[model samples]
Target: MMMKQLLLSFSALLVFLHFTTILAQAPAKSPAQAPAAQAPVLPQAQAPALTQAQSPASSGPANVTAILEKAGKFSTLILLLKNTQVGEQINSQISNTYKGLTLFAPTDAAFSNLKSSTLNSLSDKQTLQLIQFHVLPTCISLSQFQAVSNPLHTVAGSSEQFPLNVTASSSNQVSISTGLVNATVTDNLYTDSQLAVYEVDKVLLPLQVFGPKSTAPAPTAPATPKQAPPTTITPVVTSSAMGLIRHAALSFGVAAIAAFSL
Candidate 1:
């Protein structure tokens, strides 16, 4: 009877183990399908857009549109912000943050110089190491820039100044600044809000272009050719060779006679 009871217990344990193994072998529901089992509900991709009231006052997406409209002089930039990707982000920041922003915006022609693949890399603005290349972090118009001597920090987040060169403001159409490339304001195209826009010769890159920041040497005034320092000369033969030599000899003889008489 004891052996029979042991056999029955073993048989039950074997059955339990077999059931557990079968359960373990079943396929798992992927993360994609797990929610379906939980709610039998609609997928997340179909979520609703933010209503006006739902948007954050400070960082709402509408701000992007406003920046584009305000900077209509930036024809090329307008199109770039309208790019399939990252355009909206750039535009939104410009709208709300324009109070103190100096955008080193590139012209469409500037971007056209780059290969399409290069532009593709800009799709992820957050990961872009080149933001400082194109943005100034301060409020500066073309006029105030003359007073700004140091390189300003750019939204691209680097200390790089656009060199200012105002040799001629004759046309009133453009202001010139000294730099690796000439920075000029948008000509004849002004928005209701006047932003000093410039079209640069080359893309202003991050501080890496200049390397690390250091104490800039005091700007020297534009150099003047200095007169060669007046040189001192030793008389090789003495005044004896010139008319002064005769005068000196006579004066010496008089001095000798006076000394003898004394």
Candidate 2:
């Protein structure tokens, strides 16, 4: 009975050892773990758009008629420019060359102040010259008139014939004298590097066409001397007449006696 019991205990002990060996060989369960951290997402960069000022449209040549029309109060001057086709010439010059231009714009009121027949009296050629007289070949500013020499040249002709003299006062008051008319600069209508338009109070009448007339004096007549009156001779003849009458009567008496004796 003792031997059988020993055998049973030995068998049970061996079984317990085998089970422990199996548990040691197997992998152990790990604690719960968080997911792998991912890199932060970043937004893609984009290109900036261009602004209006950064990309401007190409501009066209300056137009004198359009400028005067926008300013107002220059109707008569504008009409003259169009009629003479000077405005188109100005635009063409500005577009084709780097040369600048200056215009002296007379207001409608200024035209009204002129005589009724003033514009009508001018021929087509004379009207053209008149309009050209107001424009300078080069642009000049209000302040520049002070330093400019007298009798500035115009598009009309030479300075000797179409002289345009500009004078500026201490108060910056500018005046233009063309010998025939002295016009004041009332306002600055427009000014740019290419062109300048000044509002004048009167028309710029050039000396070539509007000079004064010369009158010659009349000749004097010569003087004449006075004549003497006729003299009277009645008293002087009285003594001679009485002597002759007595002599005639004595001769007659003698002749009568002689005849009676015969």
lDDT of each: 0.50, 0.84
Count of backbone collisions in candidate 1: 8
TM-scores for all candidates: the values are 0.36, 0.59
lDDT of 2 at 191: 70
Cα lDDT of model 1 by residue, 1-262, tens digit:
9999999999999999999999999998766544434656776687475211122244333443354456454565555545533445444455566554444556556657655665454445532444335544454555455566455545444343333233324334334443544555543221212132344544444434433468779988998887988889976765557778788899999999999998
Q: Which is the leading candidate under lDDT?
A: 2
What's model 1's TM-score?
0.36
Worst 10 residues of 2 by lDDT: 49-58
Residue 158 of model 1 has an lDDT of 36
Report per-prediction Cα RMSD to one decimal: 28.3, 12.4
